[model samples]
Target: MAESRNEPADPIVRGTFATAKQSWADLFKWKQRVAVTNDYGETYCEWQSPRPLRNPISLFAQLSARDWLFFLVGLAAWTADAFDFHALSIQTVKLAKYYDTSKTNVTTAITLTLLLRSIGAAMFGLAGDKFGRKYPMVVNMIVLGLLQVATIYSSTFTQFLAVRSLFGLFMGGVYGNAIAMALENCPVDARGLMSGILQQGYSLGYVIAASCNLGVGGSTDSWKTVFWIGTGLSIGVGLIRLLFPESKQFIAAKEAGGGHTSSSPRAFWIETRKMLAQQWRMCIYCIILMTFFNYFSHTSQDSYTTFMLTQKELNNAAASRASIIMKTGACVGGTIIGYISQWFGRRRAIIVSAIVSGLLIPAWILPTTERSLSATGFFMQFFVQGAWGVIPIHLNELSPPAYRSSFPGITYQLGNMISSPSAQIVNAIAEHRTVTAVDGQPAPAYGPTMGVATAIIALGIAVTTALGPERRGRQFELAKPAGVATADEIEVKGKLNDVESQVAVDGEKPDVGQMENVIVDDDDDDDEKKR
Candidate 1:
């Protein structure tokens, strides 16, 4: 036999190892590099690298003028959408009186608005993927503005309901599209803050609505004036949106034949099926959890604040004033929660807020003088329902880009649809309980029922947190890379690589200890793991 062969030069093996080492170095250096090679093309750079800038201050410093302007555009769109919704909130009680209906009937209208808005959201979501974000957003605004103008002339309950429901359809498009537009426009590192800031528009709109409704004096028709103002604002925004540029990512995806143009009926159906199969469970859970609590909170707090006050023996004017105070508190409270989420992380922030809100619900059941109840009502919105401040942002983040609009649209609408009926349920229950005007105190039954619902919903939220993913600072692309390894493939390849590398370095068989160490280190902690 020939002399025992010395190890060959193994140039290919050496080159592969060297390439791997370089890749490892780049990964550690905080720069991301992607090398793409096709039949006639090759390029490499740190185009996909994610920078580490977590705080608002850092985000502000780093964003370009274009990015800043895009953010402002997002804020304006969201503010307009939120302003329209909350204006309805302020006018709900007054509308009830105008229609010669109970507070419960008004609550039903609010519920229908939410439900129909979800339908609008789903329609726009599909449309956003089919067309582009820009045109659809403009369409939604124009439609909503027109509807608002029509709502001004709604003289009958059917006409009012029909106009509001139609408006809801377009309202759906506003939040989802605005969120998609905002998130896609921001740099990956600044995503959380930018998204959080955009969400603040809702609170700001609430404040504007409260101020406008409070300052303006009118009969039932005065509510029409509010709709007219909303119409004007929406129309102005729609004109601005018509001028806004399409997102770069959206444009690129379209150019690559990977976006709207590439979609086919068969492909769309398949994608829909996949989305339903993969995501429907989570969607159902979210809808159930959100519906129970959101309906309870909104109807009890926003929709029925005036009615609740009247039940407690306050005059109609006093009840209306009390509702304004509660809305003011909501504005202040929601803004605080938005900032707090930036600090504590979204999931934890929501969990803590929910629990605290649950604890505060029992306070509604306690005995209080009229003056005390009004005071409590003002702060109650700040604390007892503050968790909702984070919801629009939270729901948007929980979804994947592929079906972001669809998933949120379905779940949110479903929740609203389910909650719509609660107005009737709660009213029926309150009617059943005796309301002896003793010491100017309303019956405690409604409060106790609300408190129980709050606690149960809080528990549901806490449990859901266990199943929810932590996406606070992660890059959205990393969560769902284009044409990359599946999650399972990544796990398997990572394990095999560890084994092969360990065997090569030691010049011996792989040791179990090495495998054990890899398992322990690679496994994320339960609290920190992505959902």
Candidate 2:
């Protein structure tokens, strides 16, 4: 029943916004529309009934043992990545003092890392597609662990920046591979829940980092201990990855002739070229989408604790406590909203979250006391990250199989690169407006600056997501490896991956196309049973 992609037909429709501004006159009336049809024959104004949402409990129960393993491993990798990165952000004040520099100078380390991650994503994502998911991921995690150790030993601000810049590259590579490893073979019925849980790894990392900050570095000059802890976790995650095999989706793709075609480096270039040639528009759109997303997250989070400590003049413990509360909300909200996205649709869920987040900006920033700020931070992040929960599955569904690693990873990192200076930009803006702290030192007006920036970014995300297409429940089972699946086949077959049949974990064969098997390995006799 899915549309074919072996040949070009028409673009998927979200709305007419993209084309409306081709000329000034047409732009004025761009909103006017006629009945138009997508390749799937769904009309623009069709009144379809809402898809029913799955019970969260039942959805979790449906996963096979392999599915759980893949999910947990991927989650750990992502969580560690976040933990390592946020350690730097959380220690900006201590880092500045340690290196005898301004807070902005210390924050430049964050900017440099963000700037270079696209390069890392490119390097490792190619390796992922060329080789397999496991080794490349292992390499990335190991390098990240080493870099964290290097950060702890940096003798100068320049050295610290250099180490973190290198760290960014390796850090950038993990997201694409992690999401692909976790969700590529996930059951269609459970993807929303899994996506939600996976995205929370970032928030979970922030919470853990805050807890560490409170426990290890509270009023102590020992920011080095935090970095050391991050290094240990990163190394531990790398080792953990070794215990799990490569993703079944990657295994099946390889066996079916995707990456298995050639061992030469040229094969990586050729495959990447072909994927971009067909999916360039989607890639560009995703980058633009990610630009707003990264801006929303970094703008809201990276400078928040500083804002609390410096501008609000709160104690270290109070700032850390508030951050933990905010990120905890982020974790809980992302999970709930991600699950809701299964039936509510990706774009709709994102827009709704964005709207609510924008509405909460006043309370998020206006609260003066630590207790009020903690409450506001919790609700604010709940919506901000609730929108983010949809991103993993949304991006995964948008990606072509051949370059699953490269497409999403590169695009996301590129977006990160574009928005890399968010903290600095906000800091620069805040510098123009100063306030006297209770301790008599001058502080930037971080609360007002962040409040304004978050509101605008929230609106931007809502509009962008509204105008973007959604591929909910897209198929993942392919008839052949990605190398053999033509553009036409990829586009037409979409997420279904041409797995015309499905076998359940219970050993009862489902009707053809009724369900997807999430745990079928290539060597299994049940390979056919899954698809």
Count clashing residue pairs per candidate.
1, 13
Each prediction's whole-model lDDT (CA)? 0.62, 0.80
TM-score of predicted model 1? 0.71
Query: How far does residue 497 in candidate 1 sit from its true spot (Å)?
Result: 38
Which lDDT tens digits does candidate 1 get at residues 205-317? 76666666756664665777777778888888888878868765556655542222334456566766776676665566567756755664654555354445445655545
Query: 1-531, model 2: which lDDT tens digit per residue?
Result: 454323332344433455323212321221212233466556543223335887788888888899888888889999999998899898788877888888888889889999999998888887776677899999899989999889888887778888888899899999988888888767887888899999999999999999999998565367888888899888998898888787887767665632433234654566667777767777888999999999999999999999998888898888999999999999999999999888777777788999999999999987778899999999999999999999999998877757777778998999999999999998888877987765678878898899899999999987777666565766655423334443333333433433333233455555443323322232243446446
Model 1 clash pairs?
Answer: 469-531
User: For model 2, what is the alpha-carbon lDDT of residue 105?
Assistant: 83
- The deviation in Å at residue 323 for candidate 1 is 4.2
Report each candidate's C-alpha RMSD, comma-separated, in the order given. Answer: 14.6, 11.1
Candidate 2, which segments miss by more than 4 Å at Cα? 1-50, 257-264, 436-442, 479-531
